[model samples]
Target: MKPYNRRLRILCLLLPMLCLSLLRPVPELRADPSAGASTDDREILQNSLSVVEIDREIERITAQQETIQQELNKLSGQLEDKLLQIQDQQSRAGAVIRSYYMGEREGLLVAVLSAKDLGSLIHMYDVYDMIMEHDRTVLDAYQSEYKEIKNTKLAMEKKTADLEEMKSNLIEQRARVSALQQKVDQGIASSSDPEALKKMIEEFTLYWENVGLNEVKTYFNALASAMNDLPEFIQNQDGAIRTNGTTYNIDIKEDDLNAFLRSKNDLFKQFAFHFGEDEITASGQSGTLSLEVQGHYSVEEQPQNSIMFHVDKLVFNGYELPDTTCRQMEEEFDLGFYPQQIVSFVKATEVKSTDKNLHVTLKLSM
Candidate 1:
């Protein structure tokens, strides 16, 4: 089916099934920071960049999955047809074997061998040639059919696996985005005094411009260094690993990451990161400031493949900053990464955080 046609069919039902979020009334703002989250507890209700962008990201992933599914279904149909072809080919091959065993083929061979005169021998040889031609045609067709089915099945398996992985990433993305949206809403709710909030946002923005990028990069660099600690994918650009397969996974334990980060950066000596099921939360003292950060890894396909870790929620010195501050910080800084040294070998496609580890998915390429 055409994409627009599927969209049209879905659109037809939109009126009947209105989204609950659309029906939701505007929420009243709460002045008490405790109403949403707490500053004393180091829980910061930081705002997010356009939540709509995250929504669009979800839609894009869903659409890509749907397209892959359609291809899988088409392959399934082709596989069915190929199976039928194989059955027909098998039956033809069986018939030829049965005829050969039943003496029809042997009779021709006997006559050809027993022929005495040149004329008789030539005639018998012609009959034998005709029989051989018939068998050869059946066998050749069967071989071709077998090859075709094998290729199709391999392609189907690859597509199925890719779809499943992408689906898992999609689910994780939705959960993380939902958490980010909640943070944004909470940030807005905590904005009791706009003038004071504006001043705080300005101060935070200035701080990020002056110090955040260097500190965050140092922290992120530490995380990247941690990737090397993983047993798998710890290879040179031209390493023997993943030579046959085009994709690989890197899963690092939470404790292992923390240990490596602290080792890499002394500022993170007291820092700790918790890789949740779908999000990453960290809090610690870097310099004299105690910072609490909420973030997630989002994959980017354009301008080269990379995973970007964004601080969608942040609390610096026990203040819940608004989206204005977060946006400026985000515009100037990016914390996530890919193995640049491996760019000659592979590219990262997706990432998902689990309670056990941060899972990065990469695809090998020239």
Candidate 2:
């Protein structure tokens, strides 16, 4: 059998199992299947295990922080209640003091001092003294209440500030958890599953090559078409290429492509295509495009071989071609081109390939 066919057979045999491994819940550290494996496999296994450990640690910290937050929230509620009570007591104390002083000014002293005779005068004096003493006692009670209220408020404020600090810590802790979760995800992606990773790598490689090829094709086409129409700002030359219904002059030097390609960066887009379907499943910013790629076949005739593409980066020139319509075609078809109609120029920097579907991301400089 051909090398390709043999590779395809191995891949078909291994892929489903590899996918199952990926899908399975990350193994426990002690029970990890790769624990006793070869050196490299053990390294990868240890890395995966470490990620799982970090993720688990993050979760634990998050739970602990959540518990602390709940405590803080509960304390906050209590503080609010205490503050309100303090305010209420202060208000009541103020009202009591106000009424007592107002009433004192309103009468009893003058009434008592104006006693008619001897027996009445003595009784009135005693009554006035008793009233004065009662006023002093009320004032003392108010002062004591005020002091207690003030002290309680200070304590509550301190508790509230501490709770706020704890909440901030909790937020920071949760962010750490989220960051760790992402790391774990990446670790899973990087795990060296040869059969599964192969297709994606091949696809990325091919797609990048395609990006460069398509961009060059597009630029040459546009230049040949717009030679005479170009403004004096752009130097016009005789080197041209022809495509359907158009003659594109290559006014820009060949080295210019290097500059444009260098400046242009690539953005990778990923996609998946199942065995039975001709259509590719993809997600895009604008909308989904219905892409159909020709099938890659194996010698054994068993749909065993598949290719996957991933665009690592996209790089391109910032210059716009004169033909705006063709420029749109470049974007719509994921070709590399500049159009007067487009807001910016795009390029692909890196590309990768695997043995299932094409994925590409083009970087645009607007």
Candidate 3:
């Protein structure tokens, strides 16, 4: 074949391949998950954990303060009731005293001496016994109430002192966490190769895996314990649980969640959760450090109907994490939630978030 003819044939054969390549869709690029582990990676994770753990200690102190406050309130009410009882008992005791000493109501002694027959004497004896019993009962009740008032007042004072101390300690802990967070931020900013370090951090998703999640784990620890002692927040109630035959769905509203959290731990006061368009966003601020996470819930049936909160985005200190980091985070963490952690009466089958609510589907208990 002639050279020109051969070249023309090759071009015709390659033209179809070029056209097909142009028509095919490009695959999305993602972060490399198999990046080799290194010492720097461990340091980043450890730093992240330390910061989060200290922050959680701050939360724990705040929760303890709230508990002390509640106890003091209860003691205050008891003291008030005991004071009223004491006042009423004082009046009763005064009457008994006046009757006993002044002989103002015809003394039992006079009745017995004036008795003219055996029947009259028996009646006098019974009357005296009844008067003595009444006096003794009133005196005993007054003494018991007085003791209770002393105990309640002492407890209230002690709790008040404890609350004040905890409040001071909370301030100190917040300062410490804030300093640690700033140190982490400075280290990231001052790295020799900022982009490379940032890439490594993203590939590992340490911020989501350790920093953001450590707080959530501590919160769940408190919630799991407290819920065991309190009424189930879901089921057998209006606007929360809905049932059809053997299946039920529990709708957990944003307000309801925050309220329950706040009641259990004051750490939730600065943290807020919002539900919007099948997604949940949570943000928390402490001193100069702040973080925000947005995600949606997904169900896993193979693993005992487990529900996971998939992190799609995380913003810390005004920096949005790379998409690669978010994807890695979704694979690694579940935001510390399991249906069994929330309810014991039934098994959860599915979990989905909607605008203003987290809907959980459960099989009715037999």
Regions of candidate 2 where Cα sits further than 4 Å from its true position: 1-92, 95-366
lDDT per model, in order?
0.67, 0.41, 0.68
| Model 1 C-alpha lDDT versus the unseen true structure | 0.67
Sort by TM-score, best first: 3, 1, 2
Clashing pairs in 1: none
Worst 10 residues of 1 by lDDT: 28-37
Candidate 3 local accuracy as lDDT? 0.68
RMSD of 1: 17.0
**What TM-score against the true fold does each predicted structure earn?**
0.42, 0.28, 0.43
Worst 10 residues of 2 by lDDT: 281-290
Question: What TM-score does model 3 achieve against the real structure?
Answer: 0.43
